[model samples]
Target chain A: MVQPEQIKQWIEAGLDGARVTVVGDGHHFEAVIVSPAFDDKSMVQQHQLVYQVLGEKMKEEIHALSMRTLTPEQAAQQGE
Target chain B: MSVQDRIKEQIVSEKIMLYMKGTPQFPQCGFSGKTVQILQACGARFGAVDVLADPEIRQGIKDYSNWPTIPQLYINGEFIGGCDIITELYQKGELQKMVMAAQG
Candidate 1:
């Protein structure tokens, strides 16, 4: 049972200037990550950056992760 | 042909393709089921590959797309994304436009 903060920390550490919010019940997790690094990257590429942060933890600890990744501007414009 | 070659061939042949955990009629994973749902909503004429039935293509796809997950969608030979991205796109109504454009 991984803590939400753990996931958030990993993501924040991975992406510079990233704002990560994570909510989950152990095996399943959902995340909303806003990052400047995501700017100009395709959706696939944005998700790839998140996956890189979790590394083997994604394959091991997390059963499933559903995430919404966005650029800071997109997040702000959406008033999120 | 190698699995990679076959996967590439499949991608090239199908305008809208889904590499999923189970057949669209009976999707094994929630993600795959949801993805198929979106494609159906788009009224997309898509070809689906059940990864569970072909372990070679299943593992090979991860390498092919460099994405770790099933229920991957490819439109016009381009890797769109997995379930979460698809869900988000559907919510924003971008998926409909993309799907329609792919076939148009």
Candidate 2:
């Protein structure tokens, strides 16, 4: 149901300049996200932001998600 | 006495262990990949065994931890949790402290 492309679309819609990598077996996903919107938020809040982007897709299709959210600075520090 | 027991014993015998989908060098699944990244970022020495490579260990781990998931993390003979919990812990900076304390 919640295909990878839909995730990409949702992220692109929610954030102006967000980099998202979606990896999983369809039902479960591991997302590596770098967004300027995550600059001052706590990790939980960052994850919540991403989830909000997904909207109702989380309940309808996505079963599980393992997220690695970082600000652009963090991502840059990680050499990504 | 059983496969589960053997798996438990293995986990208990190892100080820092990860029962993942594939070896640390070649993680077969995305969850396992993220687990490895978090562990690496902690800068702790760890051992990772590929459950997918062995059917016995794969099923045994589920029974050993009573957790039906790959990328299970164990520290000092205790089951920490799966990828989500690990990521959460890592984000909170608790994982680094835990690994450091364990190493010490």
Candidate 3:
């Protein structure tokens, strides 16, 4: 039963210049993360970066997580 | 053979492979169900493995791809991400392109 804020904090703490928003009911979470680290990575790699931040929690604490990873540029582009 | 090797063989055997929670017709999880819908929408002929049915694969797959969730997609032996990424790619029409290219 992990809180969304905790997940957000974990990602923010691990990633540099990351803006993370997570919403969930303790188990299944949906996260939208924008970071400079995602700049040149593929979608799989981008998610992997976030997964690394979550670490072992992904195996036990977080039962499910659906995420949208974006570079700051891509996030801004989505605004248009 | 190691579980990783078995997973590797499975991926290469099918151009499109989905390691999901259940069968496509009876997906056990919402994420897995949604993934099946997206693949069906793309008219993709994919091989599906029910992670829930096999504990070894359920655990092995996560380690195999370093992906922490179910409903993982693989196209032409490449990990394409899970349900969220799959839906995003399908919405962007990239998945259709990949499926078409895979078929040819």
Candidate 4:
């Protein structure tokens, strides 16, 4: 099973200055990610990038995910 | 006829319904909060049931929709999906159109 710490590690590996939170009920998770890497990406692309970080864990361990990807500016604007 | 049955009936009868983690007034999770924001932005006047308050509703929703997630949205008595799907649809302007059509 992919734990929250694993998600944090993945975020730290791919996103140097990202703020990521992974909340889940063991099997399913909701990830809120704010990264400078999202500055020039569409929402789909942003989600794809985060998915890439999870890689095989998404397919093998995690059953479902509710993800919200945002640039730092967008996150700041939403105050989220 | 039980609580789950009533919840299912309510979902089917309501034009726009969200089976979410918390009420719109007090969202318990970030994803549910964002889902509410997206619905509000789409100008949707919908019914929201807090799944977190009732364990039966939370588990029953998955069985009802065959979707193992909270923050599920239903429009016109159809299961649209969970928070991610809702946000994605909202961003593409599809959700607004669907809601408008349903309201008419």
Give DockQ for candidates 1 onward, in order.
0.73, 0.11, 0.88, 0.15
TM-score, structure 4 vs. true? 0.60
Q: Residue B49: error of model 2 in Å?
A: 1.4
Query: Candidate 4 chain A: worst 10 consecutive residues by lDDT?
Result: A42-51
In the range A1-80, model 1's lDDT, one tens digit per residue, is: 79889999999998999999999999889999999999999999999999988888987888889999989899989876
Maximum-DockQ candidate: 3
Candidate 1 C-alpha lDDT tens digits along B22-73: 8999999999999999899988999999999999999899889988888899
**In model 1 chain B, where is the ten-residue run with the lowest total lDDT?**
B62-71
Chain A TM per candidate, in order of listing: 0.97, 0.88, 0.96, 0.87
The per-residue C-alpha lDDT of model 4 at residue B70 equals 69
> What's the TM-score of chain B for every model shown?
0.96, 0.94, 0.97, 0.92
Work out how many backbone clashes candidate 3 has: 0
TM-score of each: 0.94, 0.60, 0.95, 0.60
Which rank order by TM-score, best down to worst? 3, 1, 4, 2
Better of 3 and 4 by DockQ: 3
**Residue-wise C-alpha lDDT for candidate 4, range B36-56, written one tens digit per residue:** 999899888899989888888
Model 2 is docked with a DockQ of: 0.11
Question: Which of the CAPRI classes, incorrect, acceptable, medium or high, describes model 4?
Answer: incorrect
Window of ten residues with lowest summed lDDT in model 4 chain B: B62-71
| Worst 10-residue lDDT window, candidate 2 chain A | A42-51
